[model samples]
Target: MSNPNYDQILVHIIDYVYHTPITSPRAYQRAHIALLDSLGCAVETLAHSAEARAFIGPVVPGTTVPNGFRLPGTLFELDPVKGAFDLGALIRYLDHNDAYPGAEWGHPSDNLGAIIAVADWLSRSQAKDVTMETVLTSQIKAYEIQGIFQMKNAFNKRGLDHTILVKVASTAVIAHLMDLTEDQALSALSHAWQDGHPLRTFRQAPNAGPRKGWAAGDACTRAVHLCLMAKAGQPGAPSVLTTPRWGFYDALFGGEEFMLPRPYGSFVMEYGFFKLVAAEGHGISAIQAAVELAKKLQEAGEKVSDIEKVTIRTQKAGKTIIDKTGPLRNPADRDHCMQYMVAVTLLKGEFIEGEDYADDSPWASDARVDELREKMVVIEDEQFTKDYHDQKVRSGANAIKIELKTGSEVPEVVVEFPIGHPKHPETLGLVKEKFRVNMQKGGFESATVEKMIEMVEKDDLPIHKFINLFAKEVPLKT
Candidate 1:
């Protein structure tokens, strides 16, 4: 029997992947920056987080795949599935990679886990002429697919994690990289949709933990695995999205179809947030406001103890997601907590870093941080919410107001765009600097760091060559 017709969403995605050519210079430029920045974030995770390192590498020790992808910042050479997981986990573990905010917020760079792994492995094993340019193109496409879906879907509101988009985006792009036909690509994508999506519970209070950090990695692994299955001749559920009771809509989306607000393109890569600081995307502006408020307190000779009350006015999404007020159990919990991030910034008079969220970090145990958290109130600003969801003006606006014990109110500090926003004047420079600092923190020498940056800037570097620059033989901790 002839195959049934594919869903329009699947058809659109496969068509974009196969026929659409990415000619936007801005998209290419942003993809290059995102590549460097994401790799830098991965290296930084290797340097700072033992918990993250422990989760990487092959499932069985002392096993290696021929012509496998080499994970950056380590000696492990893994198959594409494990490679995707390791790379994705590293980029996302600290939650410092770039993010695209919309009805559903997620880090578009999370797709890099699958893109880089599949490209690098294909280049090595099949002798395919995959270059950094190809990788960047795939990155742009993946970001566009995931970002566009996020623009109109509130997966979190349905109690699903946004990594569901990551899985779908990565599968579609990886299928293209693997040279799967449209039918196979559709089959792979259908499998991705049919796969069970993890709940958002791991990212919320009472259950927030390391699973939130590695969720994207898990998605990337599934993407690679599903594509490989499709390449091996698996058939697709053509109507997976529109199937009556068991379809994606009815089973997971409350019987509502996904709304694509725009055509697939490079807009997401060009406009996504960089996340220079180590806080949740929604709370980055709040952290900036808190840092500024801390400076004001220091200038006025006021201590954190003098703050009688603190009011944080933020977007509705921010209030819904990151406005936590209880004991944070881990880095995953703390980083997502607006109260924790703001409290740490207020106490230190500096922006919160990845180290600040560590369990052993002084700030994590400081009673003053909790005291400040107790004094702070988070409220949703309707205008901020509207701005956050506006396609023309995607702002994660946050305002902080402070009242002193001495009956004086500090002028409210409002940070509408945050430092990493594209509209911010210093975003480009800071993004580059962030990559440099991350490389240095990951233990690369100054000259080596410069060389890596230069290599990443080049358009024709082979995928294997560019990926190998990040590999070093650090003895794995037992």
Candidate 2:
């Protein structure tokens, strides 16, 4: 195979994925928790609809291997490429996974599809053997690769989905997990860089739908495919980012190279915020602020329907992403709309969950929701936007205010950090509760749930055994 001086970006990613010591026990602990939490998110999505159930499993019916990689919360066992797609899609199905805020916004746990699938498959099929500890280490590295890149690269600004980072990160780490040399890992990552990215159009109005949910999973699947091709001696394009007029820098990135805000480490996974609610990450703080506003209105015996106007003050990212109006096409549209989230919470006096945004839900048909959304005005808060991008103060802040017809107004409720922010003290407890609820919804037995938690707590558990826990057949809605 042809090998040239690799791009510095690929070199940094390869070296870190292969050589990082990951000495932080806390990092590993957090990774273990993230794994369980991702699985919980996967299981929860399994019940969303039978259509979701149809997306996973062996590509062809009755296809079987004695030790194929098992996707969590289902009985599917397949080649790692397809398996990665399945697990990645499931974790991201509800957009409820952990998030990192930066110039670009993305869910870093989206890499787990390739990481877990390849690790577990290697453990079952090869002699070197993999372990949950190994998976956690790779998980940390993947999160760092994706999250660090996310810190300053605004992919959405280029109309690209943030899953490009998912593909790059997954390819780098999965190459390492497959026991490739560092050079091979670099080659694999270069291939990933050369791959085309999906547009963000599917995530915005006029076409927003389920593609946003599966986009990251699709990236993870492609990453695995690229790594495997690299392993098979496929050549990589070393100048994919820098090559003249056709390179990513000039052609796609507006001639700007990626910015590295920090060195890669376990930092992202450790500090990445979990989602307690099922809405888009940008809208979480707004949802929190709206919930608080609803409580005050209740105390005063006021009604949201009587509101003369509603206003939302949010970070620039929130306004760019979730601030929406007009008819929401589907769950994908509703969950990403800041107005929809806050309006629903104000009307119901409760946090919005994944199911609440379903196209057929009562909230979708409620004229009150649309009415409230119509009365809402969303604006960017400069300070909130500044704090959101600040390394030392990474907060997704939002403020909500309502003016009632009676000429009285509820004081604006501002939330600097939602419940799942790393700075929030109760984040861990809330995450565990979120996981428990999802697991129970998946119809997993209490004993099985306890065992899964035990595995995450223990170090160095064999990967095959861990994968086996999720192999039990669960009934799917027909």
TM-score of each: 0.98, 0.97
Q: Which lDDT tens digits does candidate 2 get at residues 69-176? A: 888887777888888998899999888999989999999999998898888888988745787878888899999989998899899999999999999989988988
Cα lDDT tens digits, model 1, 1-478, are 1234988888899899888999999898888889999999999898888899887888898788899999999888899999999999999999999999999999999999999999999998865889899899999999999999999889998999999999999999999898888889999999999998999999988999999889999999999999999999999899999999999999999999999998998899989899999989999999899889988999999998999999999999999999998888888889989999998898888999998999999988999989889998999999999999987888989999999999999999999999999889898789889999998887788888888878988888888988888887653432
- Prediction 2 TM-score vs. true: 0.97
- Each candidate's root-mean-square deviation in Å? 1.7, 1.6
lDDT score for residue 128 of model 2: 52
Backbone atom clashes (below 3 Å) for every candidate: 0, 0
lDDT of each: 0.91, 0.86
Worst 10 residues of 2 by lDDT: 1-10
